[model samples]
Target chain A: MSYKAITLKKRPETVISEDLFDVVELNQPDLLDGQVLVKLSHLSLDPAMRGWMSPDENSYIPPVKLGDVMRASGVGDIVESKNEQFPVGTRVMGLMGLTEYAVSDGSNLNIVPKEIPQEAILSVVALPGVTAYHGLFEVLKPQKGQTIAITAAAGSVGSLVGQMAKNLGLTVIGVAGTNEKCQWLTEELGFDHALNYKADDFQNQLTNASSNGIDLFFENTGGTAQAPIFNAMNAHGRIAVCGLIAEYNKTEASAGPSWVGIIKKRLNIQGFTMPDHFHKFPEYGKALGQMLMKGELKYRAHTLEGINSATSGINLLFSGENKGKLIVKL
Target chain B: MSYKAITLKKRPETVISEDLFDVVELNQPDLLDGQVLVKLSHLSLDPAMRGWMSPDENSYIPPVKLGDVMRASGVGDIVESKNEQFPVGTRVMGLMGLTEYAVSDGSNLNIVPKEIPQEAILSVVALPGVTAYHGLFEVLKPQKGQTIAITAAAGSVGSLVGQMAKNLGLTVIGVAGTNEKCQWLTEELGFDHALNYKADDFQNQLTNASSNGIDLFFENTGGTAQAPIFNAMNAHGRIAVCGLIAEYNKTEASAGPSWVGIIKKRLNIQGFTMPDHFHKFPEYGKALGQMLMKGELKYRAHTLEGINSATSGINLLFSGENKGKLIVKL
Candidate 1:
């Protein structure tokens, strides 16, 4: 049977339009040796999807070329398996492109258990959840009672980072774009304080919230949200330069105060891509999954219907229209 | 007997004028129970002294206030001693200040061997040598065959840094102000290459010199010297933030490329005062002292005639007039 998949129509402009993607029919491939065919159940739409759109020199992975199947990770079931490693009816999620059917070599794919809800496993316990876990615990290694200021804190990674930092005994402060996101962070997510970065006096509020100093700065968005937060960093602060969602679409280099402050404060700023720490995924999955099952973790999964809606779901991420992990149910 | 000591008459502006220092008379104090009266000999005048002149908040030590005895480290004779730890006629160097006669509690002081020439011990094997040793091996830990770049490469610390990196099997590159200093770095110092930063095509020369990529950046001077060097850094480069001599006396913040490149390159920038690593001094001193005695290391000491001439000597550092360690003989 023929299956439907999204293809990149052309390179995007300042804003991603529906014209960038084309939904098309494709042949269902026969499973080769050591391969499994998966029928896509849910597709993960993340901010990093923007980086995969066009070729760039500085990113972790090569960008998606035009007319190719758009790259994505999705949770799905095994319809056929040529290898005993993954039997028929086994559920899996890995580098499955944006399609109704996908075949994997089982190189890096893992089977999802029947006990875990496929949607829940695809949502809070997905790559976004583990990215937060490893980035905060492994990269930042913030100590107890230290103040942690995280940007995009009400979003998927930021929300998890705030909760984890609080669990680790840190004074967690969240910087969200809206009052609703901030309220969720402070009331529901256990963040000690939340500041709206869109507010005029965001810096002032941050200074009051992080009175001691920002020991750990988990940067997600990189423009105006980052500028003031950088100023509030303490001496010898550790900044995990996780993502630059703020500068992803912008053409020009964003201007800000001199980082002589970085030298003066003796800060450690590190740029990280999640794949660099994939070795810790098993450990992260075990711990973070336990926390979720115990009711200690609260996460929201924003799902859009149909694989064709993947483009719009991804764009909503940059526009801040979605509150959490923006996924597509195929 | 009255002895002369250097005193700062006024804070310096342009080149330090003759009137900036005054020779003052003093009655040598009787040694207290744990004190010693030292007859000061070789006084060290460092670029860090220029840091002491400005009223900046961030400092290794507070700036020597106007009309105060200028702060310095020196070798001296213990003419009278009541302390059991240090006997009479012992040669010592510590915070003896810029003076002919000074009283020390022996808290910060260290007794030097009478056999080592006072000038040799005070010059090559002194604070500058220790600063380079600890900052490089302890902080940067550059591996063998790696390219290491140092700013102010002809000065006391930078000169030693190039030599030490060489000894550690690194390909050393020096960035200096003049052709002569550049020649000195490449010729006498055994550095692989030296780039005269004053050249119009200095950035090109730096790229050509460090063909492999800079693994360790020993930053002494800031501003124009540092702007382009950022591009030459390799991934996971370590920068020992030794000093910013270029901006030490400037009243305003000068513009340069921010360390955003550092983040992209995954650089580790650490600013430190020597006192912070005082625990490791004994280990450094022993290794460096052995290197000096073997004639494997070389240093230049720019000697000033009298203690009263300290102001002129200090300003000479900013003007880049001094060839090496600027010191005063009292």
Candidate 2:
């Protein structure tokens, strides 16, 4: 029997395009003594994938090797198993990659509850949830009643961050690219204020939205919104740099504001990635699951059908076209 | 009796020109009960003075008020005392302003050892030493084997920082604006490598100096040296933005490098000023004194004679003409 998988063909020069990947068919290997076979149901498309496609040894996580199945996390279930802990029909989630089937020796897979839909798992209990939880609660160390400004607030991780902050009694200001996304952030996600970064008066809007100045900043899209939000930070402000989706595609990323503000405000800026804290996944997943059940985390998946669409569909994230979490149904 | 002092007459629009200050002779006031009179001997000139001359509410410390004696820290002797704790002939140091004499209520002055020279006290146990200690130990938290790079490497604080890092078993690279400063850093200060930031191949020199990539960066001068040093940082790097002297005098500060490298390296950047950490001064001062007495820290005092010269002589710090610690011998 054979299944399809996407393999990284070349490194991206500037932007992600079709020539960077190749769709291939692979034969299913016989399961070893302790192996469990998982047929993936959903694949997550994230901005981090752009980094994984580039060959930078200095990056937080090592890039996916050329001629190998592209690296990714997804939801799947055990169709056949030799491991007693992971029986047949047991649903699992892990870095199962951009493939239909995976043979895991129980080291890479975690058993997940089946009642929760695949979209919910990938959206709330997977990479986006963990990234948001760590960056907000750990990196930013936000205090209740503090004003927080989040860029890319309409996207997967940003939306969760805003919701979590809002629930914790913080004054949330969300910056997005489109007014419709801004409206959705306020109307659907319950963000206090959402401003379109594309507006000519974006800085004015930011200043007005944060009358007391921002105390915490959750940076996801390091774009036009970075300077204004950074400038509006109060004394002793903290910033968590989680992602720079806006600058990843650019050959020459623009300059950030001068460090004089960093000294004047005595700000603390830290860049973090989830790979460093993978040990806390189960713990974070449990907490995130509780929040999801109580309806505290409202998630929407702008999903694509089939694994073949994964290659081109991931570009929506860089273009800021995806309305919500971008997922693939395998 | 009258004593001369420099008063802040106007805020500098850009550079710290002599017109911004007015030299005036102030009549000595009769000491009330519990008052002590200090005959100022030596005043410390630092890059931080530029910020104090401007009127910015958002600054870490309040700016000097218009029509008021300019703020500065100095070592002095208690010539007359009504306070029992500070008897006549006792030595002290505090923010006594750029003056010939100061009347203190025993609240601002800290008693100093009579054994140490006033120049050594100001250079090693005062603002410069404490700033260097706090930024290095508390902020950078450097490891013994780490490679650290410091800008303004021949200045009061930077010189101390490099020596301390070198003493602690870390490889130290010092950067400055002149060949003389760089030579002093390598030959006299025992810095492993010293590069002139103004050289045409500065970036190339930095790359050669830090072949393993820089783990710790102590930024004092945020001039052209910032980008090259920032670009040469290693993964999980830490940067302490202690000062930006180059940008302080500019009408408009230039932009910093993009934050994309911050994420790619998972870097930690923190900005700090000594005003926020004044409570630890006594502790830092004691530790610094021990290092000074043991001959582990070497400092040179570049003294300008008389109170009147202080008004114009302070510019030596901004122009990088001062060989070491800039001091006023009043």
**lDDT of each structure?**
0.80, 0.93
Q: What is the interface RMSD of each candidate, in Å?
A: 3.3, 0.7
lDDT of 2 by residue, B1-330 (tens): 999999999998888888889999999999999999999999988889899988787898889899999999999999999999999999999999999999999888889998889999999899999999999999999999999999999999999999999999999999998999899898898999999988999888989989999999999999899998899899899999999999999988989989999999989999999999999999999999899989999988999999888878889999999999999997
Q: Which candidate is the best by lDDT?
A: 2
Worst 10 residues of 2 chain A by lDDT: A53-62
Error of 1 at A206 (Å): 2.0
Question: What lDDT does model 2 reach?
Answer: 0.93
| Model 1 CA deviation exceeding 4 Å by range | A9-15, A118-124, A255-259, B7-23, B54-67, B114-123, B255-263
Q: List the residue pairs that clash in candidate 1.
A: none
Model 2 Cα displacement at B56 (Å)? Answer: 1.5
Error of 2 at B159 (Å): 0.6
Q: Residue B77 error for model 1, in Å? A: 2.8
lDDT of 1 by residue, A80-130 (tens): 999898899998877788999988888767777767776677666778888
Q: Which ten residues in a row have the lowest lDDT in candidate 1 chain B?
A: B255-264
Q: How many steric clashes does model 1 contain?
A: 0
User: Which is the leading candidate under TM-score?
Assistant: 2
